[model samples]
Target: MRGTGLAGPGHRRGATPHRRTISILTLVGVCLLALSATQTASGEPAADTVDTGFAIPFAGAPGYERLAPTQVTGPDQLNQPLGQQAADEIAGQVGLNRADALSEEQYRDLVAGGGVGGSREAAEVIDACARILTNTNGRPLYSHVDGHPTPSVLASYGLYVNTSGLLESPANADAPTRQVNSLIAPGGFVGTWLRNNGATHTLIALYRSAYTVQAVYGFAAQQISGAAQLVTNTREGVSSEVGMSMAPPLWIVNFALLYILNPSLAAAMPAHWAPIPSAVADAIRSSATGQVPFSDYAPYFQ
Candidate 1:
C-alpha cells in the first residue's frame, strides 16, 4: 500500500472538489437571477425593459398641420382670418364694432381699470390681451420681450393707428403709448377671460411686454382658446419614452448612413444613436393625412 501523506494519490490534501462545484453553481445562479430580473416570466422583453440609458421615443415635431389664419373657423364666420376673428370676438365680448378705434382716454381707462364693463375700451383691452395670449392662427403666443411690463406701465402709453394704417406708437402725440402687460393681471381682462373659459387652462404661459409694433401685432396672431385647442388637441399628439445614454460623437455619421442605407437598421439602432421609428410614425402619418389624429389618443400627449 502507498504511504498516506499530503501528496498521496488517493488523498490529495488541497483538492476540495465539492467546494469548487458549489462555487461554480453559485456564480451560475447569480447570472440566471440577473437575467430573469431583466426578462418577463414568459422570457419576453418587457415593454419598458429596454433601458437604453436615456429617454427613448423622443418627442418629434408636432403631428398636425398648423392651420393658417384663414383656415381656422371663427365664432362669427366659418373661416375668418385669425386677426379679424380675434377683433370680432373682442368686439362681441365688449360691444364694439370690429373696425372701431379706441380713444386715448378710453384706452387708458380700460388698461388701468381692466375690462370691468362691456365698454368699447374694455373690449379693446380684452382684444389686445387676447392677441398677446394667442396668435392669429389660434396657437399659444410665446413672446421674448426683455422685461415684464406691469399694467400701470402699459397704461402709461397710448396706441394709435399710424400713417402706415397699422397700430403704432405716436412720434409726438399728446397721449403716451400703451402695451399689454401679460396674459393675466390681477382683476384684469385676461384674468377674467381665463376664469370664464374652462378650456384655456392648459394654454401657454404669459410673457413680458416688449411694447413694439410687432409685439402688438402678435396679439392678433391667433385666438386664445381656439389656438390652445389646436395646440393641445391637434398639434401635439401621443408620445412614448425609453431609456438610453447619449451616443458617441461618431454615432451621428453612422446614424445618417444607417438611416439612408438601411432604415430598419436605423430603427434598431440604440436610442442614443438614432431616433426610434414608432416615436415619429404619428408625425409621418399626419403629414400624409394632412390632419392631426387627435381622436386617436387622450387629451394630453404623454
Candidate 2:
C-alpha cells in the first residue's frame, strides 16, 4: 500500500497516469535484463525439464516459471541431515516440530488432502516443496555461509521472504521499517505468512502457496495437527496471476526506492532497505563501463 503511488525516479507525486505506466514498463524491462544478466554471469544451467511426476496446473502460465527451482550451488540445505538446527528454528517459528520429519507415506497422505482442484495440483505443491528442501545431491542446502546470510532459497520456489529489509539498518529507520520488523519478530512467517498487512495481495497469495507447502510437510512429519483444515485454507488462496500481474510492479517500486531515488529520500528508508551507498553505486557504474568485473561487488553478497 505504501508504494501504490510510486512510479520511478523523476516521477512527481501527481504525474500523469500515462507517464507512470511508461515508467513501470521501463522498469520491468530493466528487471528482466538484470535477471538475465545474473543468470548468464552465474552460468547457472537451464531449469530442469524433468517431469515432477506431478502436473503443475499453471506450469506454462506466465510467471509460473518463477516457481521452479533455480540452478544454484548448494540449494538443498533444508532437507538433508533430517533435523538441522536452522530448519528446526524455521519450523518452530512456523508452529512445527523439528524432530518430526515427514515420512514418505505421510507425505502422500498430506498431499492427498491438499484439495487443490485435483491430485495433480496437490502433487505439484509437494514436488515444489521437495525441491526446496532437498537438492540434486540428495542433501540439504545451507542457507548461510560463515556469518553471512543468503537470499531465501525458497524464493526460487515462489516464496519470497516476508522479512525483507528487517535485518537491515536503514539510515533513518523510518516507520515502515519498524512495521516490517514487528511483523517478522515472531518468525511465524519464516516459511510463509498467512496474513498480509503491508505487503501486496499478490505477495500474500505467493506466501499462501508456500505456507500450504510447509503445512503439508509439517502434517506428514506429525509436527502439526489439522492438516486437512490447513490445506483447505491454502487451496482457497492460490492464484495464477500473482507472479506476472502483481510482482513486477512491486519490484519496480522497490528498485526505485533502493537505487533510483535521490540519496536523501533513499536514506529515509530503513537501513536494510536503504539505497546502495554512493561508493558502491559508483563502483557498480565503473564495473558496468568495463573498468572492472561485476565480481567487484562480491563483497556485498557476503
Candidate 3:
C-alpha cells in the first residue's frame, strides 16, 4: 500500500489539520494580549486608538475691533495656572517667616520701593505673577521691563483671560455697582474682578501700595498679603526652595506663569515662532480691546 502513505515529518502530525491551525492562532492571540498589557503600564496610548482631532483652544491672537459683549478669555490658560501654583508656593514660604523678618511698617516701605533688596529677577517674577493673577483679558495691567510687554500667550490648559474685562467684573447681585468699580479703578483689580464675578474661588497678588486695590471677597486680602510676602522673600533669597528652585530659575517659572495667564501668548511666544494672524496679532498689540471676540476664534475652541 506504498508503505501506508505516511511520510514521517512531511505529513501533518495532528488528527485534524484545521484543529491544529486553530491552536496555533490561539497561541498568537495570547502573545498579543500580553504585549498590550505591557504597553498600557508604560503610559502608551493604545495601538488601536490614537489621540487626534482634539485641540486645546488656540485663538492665534486677540481681535480688538470685533469685540462682542460675551465673556472672552484670552489665550493664556497654561501660564495662569502655573503662575498661581508658583505664587501659592511663594506665599506659603513668606507667611511662615514674614513677621520675624520685618515689621508691618518696614514691609510696606519695601513693597512701595518696588520690592527692595530683592533680585530684579524676583521683582519681575512678582510682576508677572501679579499680572496673571490680576488679568481680566489676556492683557495684564503691567508691562515687562524686558521682553513682551503684554500678557504671555497660553495654548495649553490652565487659566485663561477674557478680553472683554467686563465679564470678570460683572456686578455682584448683592453689592452696589459703584462698590465694584471702586475696586477696579486702580492699575490693578483684574484678578479681584474675576473673583467677584464668580469665575474663581480666590485670587492673589503682590502690588505696590501705590495701587488702590480691593478684593470683593474679604478673605482674598489675606491671600494677597501672603502672595506679596512670597514675592518679597523669593527676591531676598529667604526661602531655600524658592531660592534654589524658583528664583535663580525665574526664567522658567516666569515663562511658565506667563504660559498659564495668557495661553495664546504662550503659544505665540518662543523664538522663531510665526506671528499670530494679523487680526489676532493687532488685537494683542492693542491692549485697549481687553480681549478678542469669541466668534473669530470659535473654531479653535470648538
Ranking according to lDDT, highest score first: 2, 3, 1
| TM-scores, each model vs. reference | 0.18, 0.21, 0.20
Candidate 1 error regions (>4 Å): 1-61, 69-122, 128-178, 181-188, 193-302
82-143, model 3: which lDDT tens digit per residue?
23344333323222111212334432332243232323433333333334333333443432
lDDT of 3 at 155: 22
Q: Which candidate leads in lDDT?
A: 2
Off by over 4 Å in 2: 1-83, 98-104, 111-118, 136-302
- lDDT tens string, model 2, 2-55? 121111112357878687556544544554454344432211223444332112
Pick the winner on TM-score between candidates 1 and 2: 2
lDDT of 1 by residue, 1-302 (tens): 00000000121367476764454345435533553454322212223332222111111001100110111122333211224444333222222231223334434444455333434554453343323212112222232222322111110011122222222111111111122332222455544543344312211111110111112111221111110101111123443221111111112222222222123222332221112223222342234321222223212222
Q: Residue 265's C-alpha lDDT in candidate 2?
A: 23
Q: What stretches of model 3 exceed 4 Å from their correct place?
A: 1-80, 83-85, 89-181, 184-278, 283-292, 300-302
Worst 10 residues of 1 by lDDT: 1-10
Against the reference, the lDDT scores of all candidates come to 0.23, 0.26, 0.25
Scanning candidate 2 in windows of ten residues, the lowest lDDT window is 224-233
